[model samples]
Target: MGLDFVTVLFDSPFAVMNTIGLIAFALVGSAKAIREEFDLFGITVVGLAMAFAGGATRDLLVNRVPLVLQSPVEVSLGLLGVGLAVALSVVLRSPENHPITLVADAIGLAAFTTAGAIVATEATVSVFGVVVIGTINAVGGGAFADILLDRSPFILFDDFYASCAVLGGSAYWIMGSVGATGSTAAGVCAAVTVVARLVAVTYSWNLPTVQTLGVLSERMDDQ
Candidate 1:
């Protein structure tokens, strides 16, 4: 049998954005695994899951093939990301104290949300659709990780998670409506999301939930 192999680099603007998000997520996932006292193998798994899950989910939702699965370069980069996370975790040995994980998560959320907005624009989706896609792209990986860890999803329980994504997507949609596209639109989108997320984290801002929700949740707990 004969086989042909070719490289699939994350060379385009969209691909590059997605790759950036992937690496950022890997860092966050690695830190989280370390905080959980996981071994290297567990770290690798969590890192890859956090890295690729969001983008894969976004692609699947858009009816496109997942980039990591189809791209050798992306897969290699993903592995490199995992390896880097492992090295960093071992070196730091105190992941909980470092804020880099939250920073990475914010960056990843912004990048993925912006990329999804761009994809939605190219697909001629509605503004609401763009927000939905972007939000999903931003939080899908983190949500998956939380589910695996048996925790409440970040977007559902924490600081302005999906709101940042929605705002980012709305910015892009408005820019496109005003005849803006390309890097400028992407920059505005990502900036809004990242700034919002970082500020929310810094200030400990959270969405308003029923006070009884927490009480109910605690009461439902096995403990």
Candidate 2:
């Protein structure tokens, strides 16, 4: 079902490979977010939440069945990813690899954004709706993870985090309309999104900070 939707834009072996690659990227990101070892229940919760949190929310809002819930493959892969991340962190105990965390996150965000586009298009949603859903599916997990860890969401403070997802999703939607295959279009969009995000990070490009919010917060506090 997921592939069927993506096939509208990404139709090919390359796209299929890209889809799997992106999911793996997401798993690695979630694993990096896990800072410490825990019991089975704890690990399970983290893995499951990291993997399905975004897709589940996206499906609910869009009035569709959640893909992660319906597919055991996603769940299994998520668990494996989280487990490997934790194990590697424990073994390496080095700061050098910390940078890889951000890379993993960006890859995950890009891939999932494409997936969301595929799904939304399949559902016959509007373009705007596709963008919204795609963005949510891509970054929702990282956002929730940040909240759980008492940190600001990546999209709110990082270099073109959510912006990349938005662009990727929009591109996929456009490609689909042109009669591209699901995997091919999604692959291209995801790749572009990842590159764009990486460049933004490397060059420290960022949106202007909101100045009014600071003043507004001060006045509200005084009241």
Question: TM-scores of the models, in the given order?
Answer: 0.85, 0.77
Q: On residues 35-79, what C-alpha lDDT tens digit does candidate 2 reach at each position?
A: 544455665565556556777878887797876777666665676
Once fitted onto the true fold, the runs of candidate 2 whose alpha carbons sit more than 4 angstroms away are: 1-33, 36-40, 94-97, 212-223
Positional deviation of residue 216's Cα in model 2 after best superposition, in angstroms? 20
Number of colliding residue pairs in each model: 0, 15
Displacement of the residue 217 alpha carbon in candidate 2, Å: 22
Question: Taking the tens digit of each residue's C-alpha lDDT, what string does model 1 give over 46-162?
Answer: 888887887788788788998778877666666776776677776776764568667878899999998888887787777798888888888888888777666788677775988
Tell me the deviation in Å of residue 146 in model 1: 1.1
Most accurate candidate by TM-score:
1
Worst 10 residues of 2 by lDDT: 13-22
- For candidate 2, the lDDT comes to 0.69
